[model samples]
Target: MSEQKNTYRSIFLWGDKKIRPLEEGVRALVKEQFGLTEADLDQKYLYSDDEVKLDIAPALSEKQLNELQTICGNENVKTDDYNRALHAHGYFFGELLKLRKESIETPPDVVVYPKDEQEIVQLLAFAEKEKLAITPVGGRSSVTRGVETPQGGISLDLSENLNRILEVNEINHTVTVEPGIMGPVLEKHLNKMGYTCGHFPQSFEYSTVGGWVAARGAGQASTGYGKIEDMVLAMHVVTPVGIIQTKDYPASAEAWDLNKTFIGSEGCLGIITQVTLKIRPYRPKNTASASFIFKDFETATLMMRKAMQSEIGVPHLFRISDPVETETAFRINGFVNSMSDKFLKTLGYKNNSRCLMFVSIEGDKNYTLLVKKRMKKLAKKHHGFYIGGSPTKKWLKQRYESAYMRDPLMDAGIMTDTVETAVPWDKLIPLWKAVRTYLESREKSYVMVHISHVYENGANLYFTFLSPMKKGDEVEDYRVYHQGLIDTIHENGGSLSHHHGIGRALAPWMENEMGSTAMGLMQAVKDHLDPKGILNPGNTLGLRSKI
Candidate 1:
């Protein structure tokens, strides 16, 4: 395939030439749920041409392009249609819909790859001087249109060269790294040195450290290891005015926690160059896993809340799936008609009401064992049935691979997307009901929900919904459905987003969610840092600027 075709295809597939086919079981499930026929599955709707040709031309002047080439080398700056198309959008389903139709509405004028922090500083200075917007692109894994250059200036591609593990402070249990490094790369290095960062988002293989920090993301083990904000000790950000570097203090009572300020800035205020993150000893051997089946979602959440508030300990990975998700997972994994399924049925676990909970504890062997025992006891108290570690093992093994399934489903003319939000325990059920009700009200939609990350008082609900694509109206239909879902989430008292940063997808709701005063304060900071509006202009806390 041509480079353009490869680039276009990579947006949906896992890697180059690796399109994971939907399993027969999943295909059957999708057909049944959407009332699709075999012919419908065979009618692939995605663009499969060998060459991706976009009629959009470069918007930058030759003099401006030469200036960028001088700042970085000529080879480091790309103005080709392929590069522009690759950086034009993120992994948002709406963006994918546009790409599937060979549409390029707002392609960046140019893409620049800086080799180091000094180069990034120079690039930002140049962008500021020229009054051009610059959007930082790390891993290109943004699901909220966070990397899109709406004003069409420059895309600073960090994953190209600025990925490196700069320093490892064993004494302080901290690892300082360049922001472009991928999660798997960093984890492999740390694992060889008998350490682990303990942050494993589903996009770990395809996402970058800077993306994680920018998004304020949480991992599967966030329940025990905490979110990226908790792990980030210090960071260096290059803004238009100047570089802001935070000190790596264990704790401080200072007036402003600058690190926290930039943790979820989403590249609106600046570009993150380096980050220092807390690490823990790698102890996978000392891990314990268990699964339970509760009578329903409420009972499962009750047990999870008790486990979290027990004060004894919390598991590293705690997840509870709602009835829909549980049933779907069971079918996809061939759990139906299995021994466990029969056991659950014999124990009076109804089909549409039973929920599944997976628990994983990692630490000292004794501590893990003790926590496992305590969790099991607590589950029993809530009438939960222990189902061994098979469920967790399967989930862990296939967690990252699940992302690739979207490709085949999309090709089969199905639209899939995920939205996540966190809510207090008292409000979780209501919020879940509201969101599900809204989603199900849509025509021919399938909604699956799972509580992924749990805290003492609440948990994060991650919803995956699939529906038949509206053909030429995919993007518009998605916008309407997504807006309604966001509105439903807000009306039900759930946070705008639990981990996915507030990019353009969620920007319109910022003022309503945070109120005008809080947004005004954020705008003040944005204005102070980026007077020229050279940084990411459209999203990030709803601080829009014209460049």
Candidate 2:
């Protein structure tokens, strides 16, 4: 067999008794290439019994079951375990794939909650003993299929078990929180202590710190502070083999640092349980946003590109909502149409606007004012009229609720979703125009975009579209949208994903994203960490057969 095929075959035969001794060869290839040891290869590298069962599926071996029961206890696990496990994976890509994609289901054979790091180690050991395909589920808020298991396995839902503020190191100005704590709660908890974790996503209300780190998620503040990779100081993870602790280090003369590998592993290399994240002492933030009257798309897009490449207007949050999204968000917010008779006529603000650039400056009032001044001067140079100010009062009132737009579309049975990517300043405008053409050229729908996060390197724009969710062919339509978006994005020198990860929906095209060399290394790392192909299989960097 070809080496690739042999690798695939070994993964498939991992559970057979005859394969145990020979599993060493499979393990050796992974270990030698990746610098891992036998303990790393042992299914028992961490702890467990063998009796856990996902659901209606048969219970695992006595050792596996005992390990799971001991780790989770009988508290919240029982006969209803099956549905509870299945429900935990619930979230739709489109209404159509809901049934056809069911086969990919590998529901956790038994869901377990580890109350502490010690219990998690035991659970990981048990998962290794039974060679169970283990999937780490944090918030279950992924729009892409990051945490879904149709057939059944062991899902480690960290929400309840890891919900605690383990430490708040005032000295380092960093706070340590368990993975399952929600975004608002974490921020609220830290805020009272005169610190803030500025990461925010549309799903911020429901997302957890672990999920943020695992997905490498970004926030509005990313333009200023960077992604979770920047915010995380140290991470505590339970890999398939054992617990890997990345201690907090300010700087190191050491040649290599291991903390970065876990940031965007997508739960392939390890399961993130506790994160020590950098916290900024609370700063009163200010917003100085104004509407620009742009005559057309290209001019507005150019202005945005300059703002990104410019140093003067370094912003906490910067966005240029395209006419379509701006119109949609405003109307949905009842701000535009409900404009009492006077506003629209006087300001000439109508659905006719081609774009609206929103910008916010953070840190201190002086810095915010300086940024706003430089931004205003730069905007004027591009014919961008600074017509309004200070979140315009009205926009701030409705700013946080923009996520509800998707709900009505979902209710209307329209399958709508968004994809995000980032490109350098030079390619920014072309990428936008290209993405627009690709979406508009689609067979059955309209696609539009809006710039969200702006950075010195570039900016992030979100492209979205929706169509009637066809019954049997939902995957085809969803593929049409996603493929069109991702391909155009890659062709234009943008990333396949800026934040939302390479979940099951994005797996097939991972090659285009990671490239051959990186993907090869990722595969080696995956093999080293999960030789049995049991750690969140078929998602990020696994074999083609698994995908």
Candidate 3:
């Protein structure tokens, strides 16, 4: 383990735990998991000042303040005038945002809570008239710095007007919801109706439908259900000119459904108000998450690829833990009384191996059993051994419950984050190697890669980077590390982003990805709708001179 600041030592579900009497597979899993040892258990992690840092907020200019007030103009609206509204801003987690000084020093000039679509229309019109840029804000769980308001702009908080469920079409098995409605509320409503949204991510608790759509977020169950872009049937986005509602829900083949374009637009195009999504009857999920020890990262990656493309069967969720991540999950456990470190060591697993894959098959029992058998056979191809039903199932159960145990690490202020990108199988291995080479070169505290979400044609390889930031220099480390990852992604021919939007974080790469001609079309579309460039200027675009 390296010196990490504010970085939480990952309590490897079994990764870091010292074990004696470990057999071949268990010892292999431990060795493959992480580079930590019981001797290094008390290693201090560093937190980045950048991690806790935000822009300095100057007092709003008279023109900016007045313009924001009129742009809102909602009688009871909370601008800086009629009402002082509570502000919600920051990354996905609220741990840092709740700090008043952070929000105040880095405050948004105005937070408008419009109550209806007409208000939204009026606001956009007002911004256009005022020649001001407007940033569409949702649950404010954005980590890509996506929701941060640039200097001199209006932060349009859509919570008030976009929180209603418009229609629940039982026949079509879909639900139409206001863009402001966050996931937890919507999920509860659906569960009561014996239906489920079928999407669960770490931010699901606080993220909104519109935010998810705009970001093209992936659910944990994306293998079976699909990403937000796939689940969205239709959306009513407010263009700069007027409200542009898709012709019909679920789209029609008569012409291209332009709505698909906005699903991952990242608010570069317009503000989304209402979204209709395909839903299904709630089926109780019976999941079996187990782990295995692999000789190396290549073997685990290959096994994951096979399972994802397997015709016989595949689990809905397949996550592999690199040696470091496995170690973090296991060794960092502060509460390990029953399992002795000596026992784990005896399992033939060295303190270091290459990898371990966590797999979960969920659905009807009969189908899951069949899938499990098929998956086991597929594993045999990779020389993978499932420790029967040992520590694996318990590991998967605690994954989503990460929130409960994650706060301590987060509170420590480490530059802790994960980056994911989907690449075709051919390029996947190469990209993974590229990422590893970059991280390893930096000599950071911990760098682990996993195939969290998989697909038939291709799959997503997610990398979690945990580094200790030097005091007063977190920003530099973050900038260097992030640039390395982004640059490597470009060089390796992988998307700079997969689930997260290309907000300002990825804005630099958008042109390269979309190319000149396609980028021109986006500009043309923006010009046709928002000719004045009043909405989210400088996002998802390089130049709008022609458009």
Question: Considering every candidate listed, which one attains the maximal TM-score?
Answer: 1
Which sections of candidate 3 miss by over 4 Å?
A: 1-76, 79-89, 92-107, 247-251, 285-290, 333-351, 388-397, 400-413, 540-547
TM-scores for all predictions? 0.97, 0.81, 0.80
Name model 2 segments beyond 4 Å from true.
1-63, 76-92, 95-105, 285-291, 330-353, 390-400, 542-547
Ranking by lDDT: 1, 2, 3
lDDT of 3 by residue, 88-143 (tens): 23442222323312333334456677777887888788777766667787876675
Q: Pick the candidate with the highest lDDT.
A: 1
lDDT of 3 at 484: 80
Residues 211-232, candidate 1, lDDT per residue (tens digit)?
Answer: 9999899999999999999999
Compared with the true structure, all predictions reach lDDT values of 0.89, 0.65, 0.65
Instruction: Give the local distance difference test score of model 3.
Output: 0.65
In model 1, what lDDT does residue 263 have?
87
Q: In model 3, what is the error at residue 36, expressed in angstroms?
A: 14
User: Model 3, 157: alpha-carbon shift in Å?
Assistant: 1.0
Q: Give the per-residue lDDT digits (tens) of candidate 2, residues 282-391.
A: 77555455555554556777776777676665776667778776665454445464544135435544464556677676777777788888888777787676756643
